[model samples]
Target: MKEIWNLAISPQVLPLTLLLVPVALYWLLNLLGTLDLDFLDVDIDADGPDGGDSSGGHWFHGALRFVNATDVPLMFVLTVLVILLWACTMIGNVWFDASQSGLTGGLIMGVSLVASVVMTRYVVAPLKPFFRMLRADDEKHPPVVGRTGLVRTAWVDERTGQVEIEMQGAPLLLNAKVATGTLSLPKNTEVIVIAHDADTGIYIVRSISDSIPPQSL
Candidate 1:
């Protein structure tokens, strides 16, 4: 144990030892439950006629640009790798002497690098499509939109109400509502969705417009 400790604190292990800063910070923040530090904001606009960006500002439509992209996941991963490699090298140096330490450290580092690359490329990248698909489905058929059913309970003055909607050939419970207008539509009224509020996860609806008024009579 004394030899291993000495080896870990030696000049050969200086580079690896220097990498524990961000790793320690990450774990410390996680333990304190304050790790959600978002440098970007994602918002969906629903007020416009086309349900597009309502802000009309370039900043609102632009993609997230990180101030320091390398300060995030990459730094965290490298920090962990450095710490792991340092420990492995220390053990190798103590058990097999400094002569064999270099070779063993190189082998272990190479294997770890390859494993990290493989996991990132194959495992994480492939799961991205599945996550995208789930998001798309959720957006398309949000609990109250793109569904047809009867109102099971009455919606009185924005109070809570329930709707039984048929979704994907299955009945689903959904929150129901009446559009804010001059008049309030009653229960069991057939309606078509006009917009969706992402923050509230609410679907704004209007009575299906089916009319052919006399043209320039």
Candidate 2:
């Protein structure tokens, strides 16, 4: 245990180990509800031509092709890579202790880093299904038209607004706009979606609740 501890804290392994600390902290914070994974869900492929096309001769983009193919959230991939690197570095330090002594240890450490990357590439393929399942609840599913939602922004009008609707799997956040000529909806105002403009991708809403009328007694 002591030997492993020494190897983990050594200069070669310490750098990788240090990089993992913040990743651990982020996961802890996420579990505690202090962080949201929405930012990590951005589709990097969309920003580039042909949806992250690497065949265009950019080495950096080419190297990262596996990351986009993983389909898991970017942050999750980063976290896994950091962890794998730290573990692999520790293992290499132990196995090649004699060869990894003094200045030569740096070379062995580099090999461990490369090994970690290779392992991550192979590992992410099988993990796609698992990650999809893990993020299933958080994924942005199609908005249900005619469903009632509560305005979350200060005011919802023709130009700007946000709403929160209770979904079967999770709360769905959506950009909304009051139907033309309607008064702006204040925060927490219950509104029903009247129409969805697929081209514009915005929900047209009204403040009137969808309550059923009482039957005549």
Candidate 3:
């Protein structure tokens, strides 16, 4: 334990060790219920430019695309990466007496960073399906399809809207848009979900009356 502690605080790996502290704290906070971390699971734009476009103006977009490839929360990926880096540094320090100062130490640190990024990026892919399942439960499951909900937006058409449905004694709010050829629904109107798009988490809905107009009665 003493040897492990000494290596963790060594300058070669100190930065990753420092980052791990806060991540561990956040995990503890989550367990204590003081922090609800569901927001961290929200999806980002992964379809953005992969390598720059014609103008080379997609640097930020490209960065996001690369980071989002794992489909897991960025915090989770960072936590895994820091742990890996810390372990690598500890092993190197003990077995090889790796440098802890000067140019050699800087090079070691640089390599650790790049290696951690590449390792985490690929390591998290196989685990993405599991993370996505968790995300779905937190944000969009229990099969709200075919259920009735009220339009929460001023108007709901192919381009825009929202709906609120009662589920498990709480409100389940969802993004909603009418199917093609369906008329728009106004606020407070009743609608039923006809389909759900898992990729976008949007529900395709139609006015309740559209299925059974008053004239039919």
Candidate 4:
């Protein structure tokens, strides 16, 4: 235990070890109800390209693609990556006895960091289906019926999608579905927040056209 403790705080492994501290803190605060994940959400501009600061939006968009963060919780992906990184760095340091921070230590840390990203992808892949089942509830969402929002997913249909609504406060990203008999709404397609399904907490939306009109809850 003492040896492992010394290794964890060693120069090469220490950076990732320190990162795990905040990850633990975030989860602790969440469990205690002092904070929640949304407070830490990096709002991905999902409403196609014209949504927000183009550069910042593209950067996060790129990152999500790089990490394959879709259909799964973001922090879960981050947590897995952080833990994997720490393990890889620690193992590399221990195997090479490179804990004293030299060329070998730096190389171990760098290689581990790159390898961890690849490792994290495969590590999280099998867990995607499980995490997809754990959708966040929308009980606290304000009434958004009759409001308008932009489709934020590649497209929205009966089974899956998201939309960004510009309501009173900051824009709210709501899980959305298109009306039956309606074609899929593509990303950035303006649609009316027609109805809210209280039972399932999904919003039913329809494309803004001459045919369909605003709806109530």
- Listed per model in order, the count of residue pairs whose N, CA or C atoms clash below 3 Å is 0, 0, 0, 0
Which pairs clash in model 2? none
Q: Write the per-residue lDDT of candidate 4 for residues 11-128, one digit (tens) a residue.
A: 7678888999999999999999998666223444444465433445445555665665754567878898899889988888888864375788888888988998898888878865
TM-score per prediction, in order, is 0.32, 0.53, 0.55, 0.62
Question: What are the lDDT scores of the predictions, listed in order?
Answer: 0.46, 0.67, 0.68, 0.74
Residue pairs in candidate 1 whose N, alpha carbon or C atoms collide under 3 angstroms: none
Highest-scoring model, lDDT: 4
lDDT of 3: 0.68
In angstroms, give how far residue 177 of model 4 lies from its true place: 11
TM-score of 3: 0.55
Model 1 per-residue lDDT tens digits across residues 1-217: 7865566566555555666666788778977989863321122221234433243422321211111111123333344445555666555555555564566656655655555444433333333344334434554443456545554433312423345566676665444455565243445656554455554444555455322245695
Worst window of 10 by summed lDDT in candidate 2: 44-53
List residue ranges in candidate 2 displaced over 4 A: 43-57, 67-70, 133-217
Tell me how many residue pairs clash in candidate 2.
0
lDDT by residue (1-217, candidate 2, tens digit) is 8977777777777777778789889999989999875742453321234333233423433355455332556777677678887887677667777455766677776777788778777877677666555545454577578788888655576754667888887877775788787776666789888887654456788886534566698
